[model samples]
Target: MTKIEKKNLAWGYLFIAPAIIGLTLFIVAPMIFSFIISFTDWDMITSFKWIGLTNYQTIFTDDIDFWNSIKVTFIFAIVQVPCVQIFSFLLANLLNSKVKGVSIFRTLFYIPSILPFVAVAILWMFIYNPDFGLLNQFLGFFHIPPQDWLVSNKLVIPSLVIMAMWMGGGAMIISLAGLQGVPNYLYEAVEMDGGGRIHKFWYVTVPMMSPIIFFNAVMNLIGVMQAFNEAYIMTQGGPDKHTYFYLYMIYQAAFKEGHMGYASALAWILFVILVIVTLLVFRFSRNLIYYEAEVK
Candidate 1:
């Protein structure tokens, strides 16, 4: 190789070396260690004793919370992912309009997504307060009684769904970008074919934006599966464990119960579930998603 090319290559490696090193030290190393530890019983008080598949067996057969966590997590994801995606897409459509001060509205909407979840949890807690919350006060104006939003088992999941919609501003921005990228020429062509707004949207816009929509949905699914901060900070899986997510279950096992091995097993199980689910989603979406490059 030429000296100049070799020097540039060295510089490129130099620039990425820290990232590689950090990943190895922080993420990859921990993952390997956790996998190994999942097979051993270690409570941080005693030496790890190898127990084969006992931890996995216990989770699948004996522990009730594992099953409950699976149900709760899947239900939460099923509700939250599609709702958040649809809401975000609608918001993106609105924000994509040529109206004045729309950028400000977009910014206002997206601000929630960037805020720390702890802060968001605390803010929502006040809003959900039965006695003097903004939501209750607003409801009072309409003569509606104050409701136990976070405490009631039936209302808690719905309350989290609402919070999830609020945070979907990030997805809105993404959708807006996708909408803007839809070719104007295609829309004009649709108009020439006597297609109305609905026709254009259903045919051209949807097909063109399917990739972005699919990508966001996949990410939303993954994010919902890994959900932790809100349940942890706000409800602590309260009101009869209605918000007890799988990640929270892992936290409880690892930190609260000090069952490191069991927690590790739970984590691995979650990992496998997410992987399989993601693959299934991708498989199902294969025909629905439109890629322009496929034509070429």
Candidate 2:
């Protein structure tokens, strides 16, 4: 209200103006458009016609593929999220140790995460090829029969989960940084209290890293829920739609089926699902996450 206070507020707004503009133009505007589209019946070729709740009704009742996509998405998120999080956490912990060439090893591990999705998909396609692929060749040495990975309905999603974990190097790096931020004094103190490795990890490392772990879990969950590129490039949602994730199904509705309204509705559903899941995660984290100062 005072002149000095007004001047400070003006300066703060000026500093954040670019970010505000970018968010309005890119994120907020598109979300509004998408919500509007969800209520209409429009192909790109035709004018949008308002058809309230039709898209939503069809997805819940008439669209079998929509249900299938939801099921697949749920399964993928459930399996991949925890597996990748645990693996990345363990890897970060291992890499946090005082080892020789840790930087080189870290770089090598992280290269996959930086690779373009198209390149990674193609590379994995070869690796998962049924005949004469690296995986089959490796199995041959032990006299195990060659298996169809991407083409098998039972195996395709799991294979994708494995590929996702392999390239989850970015999350691992974040967890490593979190691990390093844990005070060494806490570990030493635990040891003096007659704690062993597991005790120290349970009391010190886990509590200290709780916030980062929660962050990584939420991020990975959101990413897996929107999985499309791998399903598109590798399986094409084939093997009887076993890998038909939600986003890929949305793409099909929009582009292949010429059902833009339906696609928009699906996108809205996915957005809602993500928001609910994230909120649930935050609710659950109240019991799990332990700030260092609060613990004392």
Candidate 3:
């Protein structure tokens, strides 16, 4: 190889070295350690004793809280993912239009997403307060009775879903990019074919945007399934354990209860479930996800 080419290759490696080192030290090492620890029984203070599949067995056969966490996580994901995707897509559509102050509107909508989760949780807490909260105050105008939001067993999941929608702008921005990428010529062609707005959207916009929508939906699904901060700060998985997400349970096991090994097992279970769900999403989306490169 030429001296210049070899030097360039070395420089490339040098530039990427920090990221590689960080990944190895932080991500790879911990993952391996966690997997090894999952088979043991250890509190943070005690030496680990190998327990084979006892943790797994306990989760399946004995632990009611583990099962409850699983159920709560699935419910959260099922409601949150679709709501975020659809709401974001709708907002993207609105922002994609040629309107005055559209950029400002986009910025306003995206503000909540940029705020730290802790801050968002705290802000929503005041809004959800039953007695003098903004939501109840707003409802009072119509003589509607005040309703408990995060404090109610029946309302906790829905409250989280509402909070989730407020942060939809991240996905909305991606959808806007996808919408803008759809060739204007396709819409023109639809119009020339005597198509209305509905036809143009259904035939051209929806198909062109399908790949973006699919990508966002998959990411949202993953995010919702692993949700923790909102439950941790807003509800503490309270109101009859309605918001006891699997990750929250894992957090409690590791930090609160100091059952490090059990927490590691729970983490691995979550990882496996996520992998399966991601694979299934890709498998099933084969017919649904459209690509312009595939067009003949």
RMSD in Å for all candidates: 1.5, 1.7, 1.3
Candidate 2 structure quality by residue, lDDT tens digits, 26-83: 9999999989999999998989899999999999999999889989989989999999
Question: Could you tell me the TM-score of candidate 1?
Answer: 0.95
Clashing pairs in 3: none
Lowest lDDT sum, 10 consecutive residues, model 2, at 287-296
Q: Which stretches of candidate 3 lie over 4 Å from their true place?
A: 1-4
Give me the overall lDDT of model 1.
Answer: 0.92
Q: Estimate each model's TM-score.
A: 0.95, 0.95, 0.97
Reference-based TM-score, model 2: 0.95
Candidate 1, residue 132: lDDT: 88
Ranking of all candidate structures by their TM-score, best first: 3, 1, 2
Greater-TM-score candidate between 1 and 2: 1
- Clashes, model 1: 0
**If ranked by lDDT, best first, what sequence of candidates would result?**
1, 3, 2
Number of the top-ranking candidate, with TM-score as the measure:
3
